[model samples]
Target: MPKVSRRAVLALSAAAPLTLPAIARAAGPADAKFEALAKGWVDANLRLNPVGATQVGDHRFDDQIDDMGPTGRAAIIKLATETLAALQATPRAELSRANQVDAAILENQVRSDLWTLQALQPYAWDPLTWNAVAGGALYNLTAREFAPLDVRLRSATARMQKLPALLAQARQELVPARVPKIHADTVVGQNKGLHSLVDGIVADGAKLAPADRARLEAAAKTCKAAIDEHQTWLETVLVPGAKGEFRLGAALYDAKLAFALNSPLSRAEIKARALAEMTSLRATMYDISARFLAGKPGAPPTPARPTDAQRQAAIEAALEYAYAQKPARDKLVEAAEATLVEATAFVRARNIVTVPKDPVKIGLVPEFQRGVAVAYCDAPGPLDKGQQTYYKISPIPDDWTAAQADSFLREYNSLGIQEVTVHEAMPGHYLQLAHANAYPSVLRAVLSSGPFVEGWACYAQDVMADEGYLDRDPLYLLVHLKLQLRVCANALLDQAVHVDNISRDEAMKLMTVQAFQQEREAAGKWVRAQLSQAQLPTYFVGWEEHKALRKQAEAKWSKSFTLKRYHDGILSFGSPPARFAGQLLFDLPIA
Candidate 1:
C-alpha cells in the first residue's frame, strides 16, 4: 500500500502529452495558443519528473530521478499555479472542441497537483512516497526494452548513484509526528524488498562491459546499504513517535474525491448510488446463485430480501464450484498466460470489440511493485505504442505460510484468473489502450481519465458474460457477479475508510463477509484502501458511466447502434471522462 505519487499515478494512466500533428488548414489564434501551452506543459512536467518521462517512453530524461526536497516541490507548485492562471485566461469559446476539452483536463490536473502539494502534503508525511520514487526510477529502466541493454544499464547506474542523496533528503524532510502508522509500517516492509530490484532484475537483465558492470554492481551495493540505513531510521526513530491521523476528514476527502472522480456527481450522490447498486447487485447474484446451485440438496431457496446469513450462504455455495477449479500456487502466471489466449480468441469469434494486434506478455510482478493490487495492466506508453504490454501478476510471496498461500489461491481461483485476464488483457485494458494510443490527439491520450479506462474494463467483463463467453456457463456468470459485487463494495469501502473513520475490523467485515473476498484478499485491500483515496471507487463509478453512455447511444441511434460500433466510436476519442465522451460522441457542445 505504498502512496501512489503524482508521478507514479501519471505513469500508471496518462503518460507524457506529445503534440498533435498539424493539418494544412489555417488555425484560430486561441487554438494556436492552446497547442503551444500543451507542449510547454508536457516538457516542463517531464523535466520535473524524469522517472515519469521514462515510463512514458521518453528517453530524454532517462538518467535522472525527481528532486523531492522543499525547493523542488515549491518550484512545481509555483509552475502549477501560474499555469492554472494562464489556462483560465484563455477564452474557452475561441478554441476548437478538442482543444477545449484538453484545456479543461489541464486545468484540473494543475489544480489537483497544487492541492496535493499545498493541502494534502503527502511528501512530508507519507514514507511510501520516497519508496515508490526509488522503486519506479529503477523499474522504468529495467522493466522495458525501450533502449539498448548497455544504454539502459548506464542510466540505471546513474540513478543508483543518486539514491543516497534522495534517501538523505527523505530523512531530512519527513516529520515523525505526521507519519501515519500504517504508511510507516507498509514502507518498512517495502524497503526490505527494494534491493531485490537492483540485485535480481537489473543486474541479471543488463549485459554490460566488465567495467560498466562493475560500476553498476558497486553503485547498487551502495544504494542497498543506504536503503537499509533508511529502514533502520524509519523503524527506530519514526515509527515509535508516528501518530498522524489517516482520515482525510470530510472536507479534505470531499475535495480530493472531486479531483479523483472527475465527474459531476457529488460525494453524497456517489455514496447513495453505490449503496443502491450494492443491494441491486446482490439480488442479481442471488438469482445467479439459485441457478448455479439448482439441484444441490443443501442449497437454500433464494429469498426476495435475504438476510445477511442467507445471502452469504448462497453466494459461498455458488463460489464453491469456482473455488474447486483454483490454480496451483506455482502456476498462477502460467494460467494467466493461457487465459489470455482464450480471452482473445473469444473476443475475436464474438466480434465483441476490435481486438488490438499489439503484443502482450505476462510476467511476474517485480518486488517493488507488490503490496498493492495483485495484478495490473501495464500498457505501453502512448509514445511507445509499438512496444509490448505487460499483464503483471504477483505470485504468493515465498515468506507466506501454507495457509496464507492457499487462501490467496482460492480467492484468485481458475475462474478468478480468467476474469482478471479478460479485464487486464484482451478486450479490456490491452485492447482499449491500444486504441487509445492510436487516437489522433496526443493531448487527449496524455490526460486519460481513470474512470473511462477502468470503466471500459469493467464494462468489457459484463459484455463478455453477456456474449456467452465460456458458453454462458453458470459458474463463469456467477464469478462475474461476484466480481461485480467486489466493484460495488470498493466504492463503499473507499469512502467509508477515508471519511467515516472505519476501523480494520469494520473494513474486513465489509470486504470478506459482505463482498465474499478471501481473508488474505480482504486484508490486502484494507492496506490498499489506507494507501489510496478515491481510487477504489473508480471501477464502479466508471462502469456506471459506461453503462449510461451505452444506453444513450442505443436510444439515439435506434436500430443503428451495435456494441462493436459504439465501442469503437467511444474509444476513438482516447480516454476522456465519460461525460466528455458522451458530449463528443453525440456532438453535444463542450461545457
Candidate 2:
C-alpha cells in the first residue's frame, strides 16, 4: 500500500493526518486495502469528536462539534469497535515492520477509548472534566496564540454557534441513574471554570462581525443555561447522592490498564514497580535532606511532623517564592523566553541537535482556562506550519488569600520552578512538541502517543540535570527528587482512588507521609486524580522508558556517539511510541 500523505488526511479531517494505513505500510501491505482501511479509520475518529479538529487548529468542521449525547456516544463506540475488528483482521505478514508497530499503536488507541467508555462507565455526571476539556478547546480556538486572529475568530464563531446544542447533548447523554458521587463534586468544581469561559466570550464579542456576534451571543446564552441546569442537577441529584469515592474498583481498573497502557504490563506490575521506585526515591530524599541540613540546622531535621494545616501553609509559601521573583507575570514570561533561548543555545553549544527556527513564544494562561494546570506548552497542530508555540503560565488567582497564595508558592520553590521551566519551556514539552508538530506524517501527530509526549518532558528534566544544570546544586537536585516523588505519588493515587477502595484520608496520608506533599497540594492532587484517567502515570513511566532507551542507544553507538548526535537522533524519529524509538534506533523489529 502507498503511504498516506499528510496533506490528504488533513483534507479529510482538517486535523493532521492520522491514518493508520500510512503508519501500517511500514509493516508491509502492498495493496489498496491499507489505504481504504486508513481513510476509514481517520473518518470515524474525526466524526466521533469534532472538537479534536479545533484543538489541532483545523476549522473546517469547527461548526460541527460533538453533542456528547447518546447519538455521539453510540457513534464513537461503534467506530472504535469496528476499527478494532478491522485492524485485528489484517494479515500480520502484510505489515512492514514499522507499519506493524503503527497498527498495534492504532489498535491500542481504539481499544483504550472503548475500554474507558464501557468499563469505566464514567459517562454519567463528571461534568467537571467535560467542562475543563471544552474550555481548553474553546480557548485554543479563540486565543489566536497558535493561528492568526481572524482565522481563529471565524472558527470560534462557528463553534459558538453550536454551543447550546452541545451542552444540551451533554445533559441528555449523562446517565442520571448512574451518576457517580465523585463525578458530581468534580462537575461542581469544573463549572467554576466553565462559567469563566462564558464571560471571556461575551467580553470579546466585539471581535466578531455583527452576524457572528449574534451567533456567539445565542451560543453563550445557551451555554449559560446548560451550565446552570447542570449545576442544578449536581446540587439536587448528584451531590445528594455523592459517595465521594474516586476509583471505579479493581476489575474496571484492570480493564482500563490493559486498554490505556497498550503495554503488556498489568496494573499490579505497575504498582509493584511504582512501590519499588517510591522506596528508592524516599531514601534519596532522606539522603539529600541529611546533606542539606547537615551542620547548619539547629535541630537535625527529624521529619518536621507538621500538622496538615501547617504543611499546607509551608507548601503555599514555597509556591509563592517560586513565582514571586523580580518580574511580575509579564516579566515571568520574558524569563521563559530567555529560558528557551538559553535552552537552544545550551544544546547548540554542545553541538547536540538541530533546533528549528520556527518561532516559539511565551504567554500567560488565558483567564477562562487558568485553573486546570499551572503551565502548558501549546504547539500548533501538524497542519499549522510556521506558527508560534506558546508556553502559557497560569497566574495565581487574585481572590486567593495571602496564606493560601503563600502555600501555593512554596510548593513551587526555586528548584521546583526551574524543573517546571524545563518541562514547559526549555528542552521539554515545548521543544519536543515543536518537532512533533513538524513530523512528516500528520497521522502520528494527531494520534500522538501520550507516553511519548509526557515521557519526553519528564525525561528532559533528568537530561538537563545530567548535563550539569544548576551546577548539580544538591538543592535543585533535591527539588527534582521531590518532583519525581510527586509523579510517583500521582501514579499511585490514580490507582488507589479508582480501584483499591482508597479513602480520601488514605490518599492524603500517602501523599503527605510517603510523598511529603503538603495537605493543600495533596487535596489538589486528589481532585486531579479523580478528574483525569490513565494520564498521571505517564510522567514516570515515560521517563523510565526514555532513560532505558537512551542508555541502550549510548551503548550501541559507543565511541561514535556525540551527545548532540544522540539527542538529535532520539528526537528525529518524531515522537513515535518510545518502544518504537528503541526499535528504529537499534534496527530491531517494531514489536
Candidate 3:
C-alpha cells in the first residue's frame, strides 16, 4: 500500500465533500463519521509504516524505519481493532450504495490486518518480513527521482544510521526455534545483496557536497559492516536451529484464504471450481495439440479422442516448436522490449481498451528484490499517478549451472515472453492501474484489492488470444493455453502444499506432468509456495470472477455490449473487489 500526499487528500476532501447521496442524506452523521475513521486509519498506517509511506511517494517519513518489536506490533493491533469497531458501529443500510461498499471494503481490510498481526504472526518466524523492511527503506529512497539528490541522500543517511537498531530489534524479536529453514536460507541470500544499496547506488550515484558526501560515505560503511555481521549471525546462529513448520494447515489456510480472496466463496468451493476448470482447460489444450500434430507420423486424427499418452506427446511436440524460438540468454531483455512495442500496436489497432499516455520502462530486477517471481508490474504508487511504471524482469543468475539456465530459458521462450509482456504491460497491469489511479476515490485507490489487480492481468491474456493477437498464430495460442494451465495449477498447488501437506515429489509431478512446467520453474514455485500462502491462488480466483462478471454484463447489455466499453467500465471504479465493480456496473444492490 502507498501513502497519499496531504495536498491530494485535502483536494479530494474539498471537492467531494464525503457525505451520503441525495437519497440517504438523512444518514449524513453516520456517513461522515465513517469517512473520518477511514481517513484516520490511512494516516495512522503511514505514520507507523514509514517505509510503506516512502514507497508511495510520501517523503515525510523517508528518514525513518518502522519499529517491528513487540511494542510496535501492539500499536498496530490496537489501531486495527479500534478502527474495525468504529466502522461496525455505522449502520450499513443507511449509507448510499457507494459508501456502503466503501464501508465493507474498509471493514475487511481492518480485519485482515488484525488477522495478520494476531493469528499469522509472521514477525516471530518469517525473516523476509524484516529483510524487506530494511531493503525497501533504502530502495524506495534511491530508486525514484521524486526529490533532489542531496535531500534524498540525507534521508538515506538517516535511515542508514538506524540500521543497527532495526537489525538489533530483529535479533530480539525472531524466535530461533520457530524459523523455517527455507526462509532462513532466503534471508541469508538476500542479506548479501543489501550492500548494493551503498556500493552500487549511494556510492556511485549520489552526487553530494564534500562534507555531506563524507558523512554519507561513513554511514554507508557502517551500514555495510552491520549487514555483513547480520548475515554471518543468520548463517551460523539462526540456520542451524531453524525448525518451523511452513504449512498453515486447514484452519489457518481457510482464514487466510477468505481474507485474501475477499470473495463470498468457501475454500471447498474454490477447490471444486479450480479442479473442474483444470480438466476443461486440459481438454482444450488437447484439441489444439491434435490440430498441431495432424501432419506428423503416427499422429491421431483431429476428431479422435486421443489417449492420455498421445495427448501428452502432441503437447510436448508443440512446446518444442515454441521453445525453439527462444531468445538467447543474453538477449532476453531486448526480446521483451521489442515485444512490448508489437503488443502496444496490436492493442491500439484492435481498438482494445484505451491506453493511457503514462510511460512504462523495462528494466532488470534490482538485486535486492530478486529471488521471488521472474517478472512484476511495478506501477507508481496510486498517490503519484504520473511517475514511471517499471516492468522488472529477472535475468538468470550468473552462478547457475548451464543446465539450470537452459531449463529457465525454455520456460520463458519467445512465445512465453510475449504472453508475459501482454500481462505486465500493453492491455494488462500497466493500463488498468493507470485508470485506477485516475479514479476519483483516494480511499479506494489506496486500499486496492489484490484479486482485482491480478485478475485483470489474467483476463487480459484471454482477451488478447480471443481477439486474434499475433495474427492468431497457433503457436502463440498454444502458449496462451499453457499459461492458463499454469494458472489453474497454481490454485491447486497453493492449497495442496499448505493444507494437504503435499510433498515435493507430488508437487513436481503435478507441475511437470499436469501443467507441463519446466523443472527450474517448478523448483522456484515450490520455494515460493513455502515462503507465502494464499497469494498464488489470486490469479486463478480473480480470473474466474472477471470472467463471470464479463458474462453477466454481456447478458445484461445484450445487443449494446462492446468489449472496449465493458473493459473501460469495469476499470472506471477504482480497483475494488470484482463484486463491488459488478454492483456499480450493472446497478445491482451492493452487498
Candidate 4:
C-alpha cells in the first residue's frame, strides 16, 4: 500500500474520503486492518473539520471550511458508524500491544463523536460549540507558522470567504430556547473577538503575494460582516431566549464523563475520591502550615492534633505569606518565564525525567480564547516541523477593576504561579508533550487522552514539590497544597453543578472556603463549571491515576525504579489514558 499524502486526500473528493474501504470491512492482518480504518477515520475527520485539520498540521484541508449543515453532519454520522462497526469486528486479540491501545483510542473517539452528534447534540444548545469553531477556524490558521505566509494567507482568505455560511448554519441549527444563557452570553464576547482575528489576518496579508493579498483583503470584509451579523444574533436573539439547563443531570453527565476521561471511574466514584482528597490535602496543608504559622502572631494553635478551626485558621495564615509575594499586575508573564527557567533547572538538577529540549515560549492567551481558563500549553501539530509550544497565560483585561485584579493575583500568588508554571511549562505540559509528539504513533498523538496529558502535568507539579524544587520552601509547599485542593474541588464542583444542582452560593463557598480559593478565582470558576462539563475532573482523576501508577511501578520495579526511568517509560507510550499507559509500561495485558 502506498502512503497517501494529506493534499491527495483532500484533492480526491471531499465527501468520499470518509467511506470505509473494502479492506477495513474485510480484515486480513488485524493490525493492518485497524490501520486502514484509522487512516480512513483520520482522513474523513480532517475533511469534516478542515479548520481542525490545520491545527493538527494537515494543511491540505486549510482551504475548506467544515460543512456542519444537515447533510454534512449526516455524512459524519455515517463515517463514525461505519468506522466503529469495522473497529468492533476487528480481532483485538490478534493485534500487537501498541495496536491494541490505538484500537481502543479509536473506538472511544468514534463513540464519543457518535454520542456528541447523536445524543448530546451541543450544536442545538451550546452556542460555544459554534463559537469555538468560528473562533478557532482563523486563529489556528494564523497563529502557527506551519507554512509560508503567502500560502497560509491564501487559505485564510478561502476560510474567511466561507464564514457567512458557517454562521448561517450556526443560527439555523441553534434552537434559541435550548441554548444556555451563560453559553450564549459568553459567545457574544467571543464572537466580538472574531473581528480582531480578521483584522490580524488582513494586517498580515499586507506581506502576502499581490493576488493573495487582494483575496484576503476582500475576504476580510466578508468575514467581518458575518461576525457582526452573528454578534447581533447572539446578543439580541439567542441570549434573551436561552432558557436551557446548563446541568447535564446524572445520565448525560455520566456518558460525557466516560468519554471525556476514558477512565473507569464513575461520577459517584470521582466525587467521593475528590471530596476525600480535599480533606486529605487540607490536612496536609495544615501540617505544612503548622511549620510556618506555629507561634506566629494571631495564628491559631497548631497542636499535634488540631481542631478544624485551628487547622483552617493556621492554613489561612500561612497562605498570606504566599499571597504577599504576588507579582505586579503587569508582570505575570515575566514572573512565569523566570519560574519556567528555575523549574527547568530544578528538573535537570534532580534528574527527574529525560527533559526534552523543545522550545517552550510563553505568551498571552488570545482574546477569543479567554474566559475559559487562565493558561494552556498549545503545542504544534505532530506533523508540523516546528517544536515551539506556547505556554499562554491570559492577561488581565484593562476593564477589570483593581479589586478584581487584586483577588486574582492573590489566588495566583507567586508560589501558586510557580506551581502553575510547573504544570503548564517546564517539566509539565510542555516537557511531557514534547516527548509525546516525538513518539512514533501518529494515531495516538492525534487522539491523545486529556487525562494523560493533564495527569502528567499535575503529577509533574507533585514531583517538583517532592523534589524540593524551590528548596523546601514551606510557603511554596503550602501554596502547592492549596492549589491541589482546587484541583480536587474542581472535580467536586463539576459534579456538584451538573449533577447535584448546587447553587451559586454553595459553589462559591466550596471554592473560596473549602478549597481556599480567592473570590475572583471562585467566581471565574463558577462560570467555567457551567460552560464546561465533565472536563474539570480530568485534573484530579488523572492526578490520582498517575500517582497510583507510579506507586505500582515503584513496588514492581523495586531497585530498578527511578524517577527519570519511570517518567520516561510512561511518557514513551504517548498520551494514552493512564491505565493503558500503565499496562504498556508494566508489560501487562492491554485490556
Name the better of 2 and 3 by lDDT.
3
Model 4 lDDT on a 0 to 1 scale: 0.82
The residue-by-residue lDDT of candidate 3 on 180-257, one tens digit each, is 998898889888889887675566435788888888888888998899889888989889978998888998999999
Worst 10-residue stretch by lDDT in candidate 1? 17-26
Predictions in order: lDDT: 0.81, 0.63, 0.80, 0.82
Which residues of candidate 3, in runs, are more than 4 Å off?
A: 1-27, 204-206, 297-303
What tens-digit string does per-residue lDDT give for candidate 2 at 19-114?
111233333343245546766776667655666665565556665666566676677788889888888788755766555555666777777767
Q: Quote the lDDT for 108 in model 4.
A: 91
Best by lDDT: 4
Name the runs in model 1 displaced over 4 angstroms: 1-5, 8-26, 201-206, 303-308
**Model 4 agreement with the true structure over 515-566: per-residue lDDT tens digits:** 9999988998999999988878888989999999999999999998999889
- For residue 86, model 3's alpha carbon misses the true position, in angstroms, by 0.5
TM-score of 3: 0.94
Task: Assess candidate 4 and give its TM-score to the true structure.
Answer: 0.94
For every model in order, what is the number of clashing pairs? 0, 33, 0, 0
